[model samples]
Target: MSLGDENDGGQTRTRLPDGGTGDVYGGARRPARNSRSLITVVGVVVLLIAAIAFANRSGTGEGTSDDTAKGPGAGAPTSATGVRPVTGKDGTIPTGYAHDEQGAQSAAANYAVALGSDGMFKRDTRHTIVRAVHDPAVVDSLLASLDQAYSGTFLKNVGLNEDGSSPEGLTFVSRTVPVGTKVTGFEGDTATIEVWCTGLVGLAGEGSNKPVTETWFTITQKLKWTQSDWKIQSSSQQEGPTPVNGDNRASTADEIAGAVAGYGGFTYAR
Candidate 1:
């Protein structure tokens, strides 16, 4: 089973595998590190340290001049506005943005998280998510496309049951954490925003071929203000500005499952 390649309104959708292909996890286990790999990692760490030092040196000053700190391009200080996140919910997803640029960024970030979540693998929750964040004009079409994308075969490829549930004694994890967001365009009820995100995706359990792993990606959303809030009109994703892996030890499957169960996700605000 494959979700064959297709295009929808200029968005290029690729085929998702139906079998346990190594492409998703690269492999079941980490490859052995050679001397060259170690050396390269050391070099990257050295350069990163140097860059941080340089930035720190450049940032120091007696004080920021009022003239240099006043404009949009200036390094404005961020302080708490004492405002709470939007309390409205569209079937567990947040709604009711401020109808401004900041609202657009907030909407984009939250939408990215919702779209990248494990809920997307199941049929009913997938429909709820799509309807909640997408524009009315595109909701039905998007739902249809996504239903195909997350079909039973596709779910099986990622080590899920036909209905997108984890097999007994295992945990399936798919979550997106937004690192930051930027608004590239905002004008008259339309906004284009980009969200940089890191995500966890796979199954966590003994004997599971698909071990949970981390991935970095950026999502660009074209949004429109409609029905008194910002909604996604279209979106695209691309491989990330990924960083070098650190030396942290990998956690056991049980530990990962426990962490996921104990911790809840956040509602982002800008």
Candidate 2:
């Protein structure tokens, strides 16, 4: 039942990178602390909280649902298909998504790149990604929801300027370079792809501000082949239970900054 680890399990939940209520309830508010005295209060508070949760059905317990915010699902997959983009298309992304399990996995991999990249942080690019990677039947509705999700607050939190745009002289980009992909299952039309990746997301400019920070994340995209192309119906991300680090020396801000600024982005190939 290791989710995103190259194995198999249950369905993953797709969430807006920022908004909406997640099964993890990660964004929900914590209950206010009681003003009661120490020792007895602490013990009783636990039971009380449980009782309240039973009555309220809100996030009042430390069960699987609570723990989910910290990790991938227990029933998620551990396939190797989520790694790279498919190759040989007209550089037009989504050129040839397969129709079976393998194709669905490929679709998942590409969609992960589409969803996790800096492309999602802006309006136009977001539209392109949504249209490019989503199930067409639900694309319009998802687009509307995505438009609402990339709110001013979410962009600001991600180190973008207040307008969901990068600051002048600085380019904001987030790209996920899929290190690898694995297929967990290919039953009929539904398939799972676990894409292990390292993401670059931050402000890029010389002596400007908000230096880019890198993160390793794995995204699981559940895909369905539709209308000749694979499409993402749902997906989710998790922090790395990553590998031990090498002794690679850290690059200078100037070097890192230069790479971020001067290097042109790629459309990625298989």
Candidate 3:
């Protein structure tokens, strides 16, 4: 009988031979219950053992050899190097990267941060940042380019004063956080690095037309080793590897402004 069929009293019933000793197919003896149970137990034990072996191979188990258990391939994109961050600073930007791949990546990341900062919206700080992070050969041209980009018209459109200051009771937010860095090319004195970044930019205040918003972009920096540090020779940015927005509630303008004022930016490193 079909398993779904029920008797009149709403109970299911199955027909069996008089002795209850035959298989459903009739006349064949069924395997012993203990044998079936044993098979199931063995299957479960095998799976458990496999899981344990995998865990140990991945370096999570005691007595696993460090060398075989974890290789360079095991590291995540955001893995830490355990090396201390550069101690030197030019103004607020980190400086004195090691003359190696790690140093080049660190300089590129920090440069991306400085260039995407609110300071770049203002003239004097913008100049300071440009000069500090760029090669001397490119500094003048870069300054001119940046000045034109942050012109009064651009500033006004973004709800900033001619001097790049926010209007009364408003806060202009522009900040870039580096998500990761990769060195695409590294020669003796030059390196090309790409920094994946997410940034915030807009005017935050009640009744403001330009509410603070987020953007994702990657900045590719061609760096030159000069003056005992890595400096940007040229750079370009392109939008996103953007992620979908989460279901968090948007905060008030006041909260955004307060947070900006309270939290300081970091000096990024590899």
Candidate 4:
């Protein structure tokens, strides 16, 4: 019930993970699933993508310029929702995102979640998700490029049994976590934000090869408040201030598989 900036309107809270990153996604629908196998595909896709910048030690903009201290500004909206398997209107896209510079940061965070979710893997859902997150004018452009990026053969190779279905008993999991957001610039409803993120991707099934892995990326979005919502005008991503992976024992195939089925996702705000 609580999670956005206070002065703004309650929205989503940034996760503030190590090295900076955050993410969210669809968790209710599953055909079969997998996790490890996702690592390979995600890594390759990230490495080859166009480079861009969002927030950083040297970014410009509206983030608390007090040297990246801690917490939202004193004038923030609310707090984090802490809800899982998230759904509905807030679940569909970000809410209570600020209308100014902070709004841009919120947009970058939400967009990172939208970009790194399971929704991107499927054709129809991907289109819907893209339309929901990006500005109307650029939706077609983003969709076209993404459509080409996620081709039919690509889906099948990554474990989807064609038609965007997971293999017999596996579930496909793709999640991005926004570590933090910093506004580099703002002018009117048009603003620039860099959302730092870390991602978890893979299929959670037996004999999976991708074994869930993690990655660091930052998404820079040029956002505009169109039709009364913060929509992405254009966005680009790149590698990060990445940190070394932890040595925690990787979750077993069954554990990871079951969790995706048991847990859920959330609607983010900031």
| RMSD of candidates 1 onward, in order | 10.8, 15.8, 26.4, 11.8
Candidate 1 pairs with clashing backbones: none
Instruction: Indicate the residue-level lDDT of 135 in model 2.
Output: 74
Q: Give each model's whole-structure lDDT.
A: 0.57, 0.48, 0.57, 0.53
Q: Which of 2 and 4 is the better model by lDDT?
A: 4
The number of residue pairs in model 3 that clash at the backbone is: 0
223-247 per-residue lDDT for model 3 (tens digits): 7999988987765555466776665
User: Stretches of candidate 2 above 4 Å error?
Assistant: 1-91
Error of 1 at 228 (Å): 0.1
Q: Compared with the true structure, what per-residue lDDT tens digits does model 2 show for residues 1-270?
A: 123221222323211122112121122332222212111211110110111000001122243222111122222233232223345452345545545444554456555655666656678877876777667876776677666656686566555765577866666766656665555555567666566766565555554334454455566566676766666665555556466555455454456657776776545434
Model 3 TM-score, all chains together: 0.70
* Decreasing lDDT order of the candidates: 1, 3, 4, 2
- TM-score-wise, the better of 2 and 4 is 4
Clashes of 2: 16
lDDT of 4 at 247: 44
